[model samples]
Target: MVKRCSWGTCNSDTRYPERIINVSFLPFPKPKTNYDACLRWIKACGRPVEQLNVNKITRDTYVCSKHFVGGFPSEKNPDPFPATGGQIYEARVKSRKRKYVELEHNSAEPSCSVPEVPCIDHVNPIILSRNENDKDTQTDEIVYTNLDLVAHNLSIKNLEEEKNALIKQNEDLKMQLASCVEQDFKLKSKRSPAKKHKQVVNNKKFSAETVANSNIKKLFEYYTGLTYVRFILLVNFLFPEEGINPVNYKEKRKEVKAMLLTDQLFLVLCRLRNGLHIKDLAYRFNIKPQSVSVIFKSVIHYMYLKLGYLSYWPHRDTIIQNMPQQYKQEFPTCLAIIDCTELKTEKPSSLKSQSQCYSDYKSSTTLKSLVVTDPRGSVIFVSDLFSGSISDNEICKESGFYKLLQQLKDQGYLQDNDGIMADKGFRIEKDLGELNLRLNIPPFASTATQMSSGDVALTRKIAAHRIHIERSINQIKNFKIVNRRIPGTLFYNINEIWTVCSLLTNFQDTLVKM
Candidate 1:
């Protein structure tokens, strides 16, 4: 076993013991046998406690002889204080005293005597004497010089001059700092009035223009569910002739407040995206809650009409071109993936209405809608809201999706061999077969207790590709207006709000990028 010094900066090791002369590695005192000594040794090593755990110390752990007094520890000096310039002098003094005592003991015979020199005050002397039967001792004294005192006084004078110079320099720096501070105060005072006026104007009003430019992207996305650029694009799209259309639009609705169209759009988007209450919006926009309600309804209606075409069904060529590779390989002819999503709503006061809206699937009152997306994750069609109690088959038939497909097929936008992928709950296989359209869904193990390997693989493949539709639905629900429980106050506009939110998600970046 090789011994290694545990001191942080030590390179002493038994492997190369010859490199360092007169150095010996000492084992750490066993904590069980000498706990206090072991702790002292560890502390003297100058290593962090975490790096040197006492319990983990093995026989190989060591501290080099250089760390102890007298080059190594001994009974005479058991402590392991590190050997330093100051400690070496103390050790030498103790050794000299011990040697003198030994010499006295060795000359114990009656004739063997050693003379001691007497110490005199105010004199430096060198005296050497040999004992001779108590003869008088002779001493040589050296006189002190005035030169030493003059040099000491000169050093003191020089230090005082240096200190005075540093004090003067510090005072100069302070004066310069004060002048700089005064100039800064004057500059700030000159700009304060203009800055104060601007702040007051900004604080007294809340509008789209008030948000800092650097934070527009994040803040607009938060409040509008769209970036600043996208929000501007949306604004331009909806109110094309902004100056003429918006004012006329507001006047036609008999809205009293002369608010900007951008502010109106911002208010509506905030209400929908953040789910903020009417009174909260009123306070924010500094308008009556009644005006807020009217603006929200009018803007939502205008948006619903303008953005309705966003979810129109695409041509077969376009769908095929944008389909992902995973779908291209397994579901090459797949046209659209369909899934149903439900939004929880407040309970109705009427027992009959409650019974109609209560869904066993969610164990709550919900309004369900069917969402359809192409293989590349663009929403193609979104069905009208249905009672939550309705089944997938009932909603599909009632949603006019099959009729729309037939119509698209008649217009050559769809073909006979194209497929529609859906969850197993849809149960629209026979219905699709009548229209010469293929139904791609997972297989059910109804025929036997378990499905065969081929059926299981088919189900796995279909389910894997079907997940994109779920992602599309998730993005639509990202709009908070349709995500949370719908308030009774907005129950009348829930359908339009839900439809508008579904269409708005298409304006976002494509879910499955090509």
Candidate 2:
């Protein structure tokens, strides 16, 4: 194989495994600059690089003359400066070191405190030595021009670098001094101010507004049994005057603080629909139980006012128009189906309340309501809760539905011929007949007789139609609070719970087609 010598100075085109006659081969060593210039010369002596076993050569690396026998280098022929092993070269370099040392010692005057001197015999360069020597300008000039010119240039270069570095450092120190002076001046000019502050965070750890954004969407239906859209609609319907109006509006009412209109509505619905304790709601809405109670009371009263109009028993004509085919065919002028629903609750500790609330029928302390739905299964009316101990006929009358019917009939909205369909549980036929209104009740078994086939068919038919009120009541009781044993905390305003739940059912998707 052909190989070109790596040295520009020794550009040989000889085949491998053959020696270059005059060049020396040295492996690149641990750093020493004295070996550098020697590697740059062409030579016709010594073993080839392959024999020296330098398998690879990088741009910065070298192998050259001073490592081999005939390639011994001297000061006069210092193109490839002598390697460290040469005794003659070492002596010459040592002599140059002493000369520079003497020059530095003699020149250590006031002007040259930061000394600038020739570098020679780099193994131990002549630094600022204290020993002085005779000053001879001619000798110094001869030594500098001939032997130490490179060393002289090197000294000048180092001195220039030091001088530039010192100048930069001085500029940095001046800048820092100016900045420090400015800071001191500003500090002295500024005056101290009075100490005062206002409360920023609310007293409650979580403000109502915070809870509404984070948990309301995720738990909207679970807590309220209403979607976000339905909840907002309910809020807008009930509390329109409480908020800023969009058109021809004035903000007279103090804007609700912290809690949003939606949050207030959602808060009440969660409690009523879930039958959750005020404290449980407090945790969910991130507020105290007292706040939950206050919000609950306010929302219930608000819903009563807003939703009471839905309980308006429709005129006989309106009912007839909206009645389903089954009712129209079987009992064409049937106004509505009526039933009583029971809500189990805590036994009141007070004798009076317990006596009033206890039901022999359910054998449990319970709340009851008169739930009414049109033939198409839409809730047209829900009475305020009554004691479960109250008889169905009494609840029917005392619920003021009888009075409402009487008023509507007197006002000519209800007709004498129009009637209500109910299960045999309601014995209001005679009472309603006194008002010249009919009550279509399914027949019950007498003591000694069996119901005829036709009578049984009629009862079954009426019972089938009665399922509408059953479904309507079921919907209201779907709120766990109404379905489960009541907590005493809500026993006081249990009427409001029944009223709100009953009214909310009407706002849901139409239960019966018109």
lDDT of 2 at 395: 90
Where does candidate 1 stray beyond 4 Å? 1-205, 212-217, 246-257, 309-311, 447-449
**TM-scores for all candidates?**
0.59, 0.55
* C-alpha RMSD for every candidate: 20.8, 17.1
**Model 1 has how many clashing residue pairs?**
0
Model 2 C-alpha lDDT per residue in residues 70-128, reported as the tens digit of each score: 46444554434323222323224334433443233234332322334334444333233
Question: What does the lDDT read for residue 232 in candidate 2?
Answer: 67
Model 2 clashing residue pairs (backbone): 21-44, 21-45, 22-44, 22-45, 23-45, 38-80, 38-81, 345-486
lDDT of each: 0.76, 0.65
Question: Model 1: what TM-score?
Answer: 0.59
Residue lDDT tens for model 1, 239-268: 888465543233343343567788888888
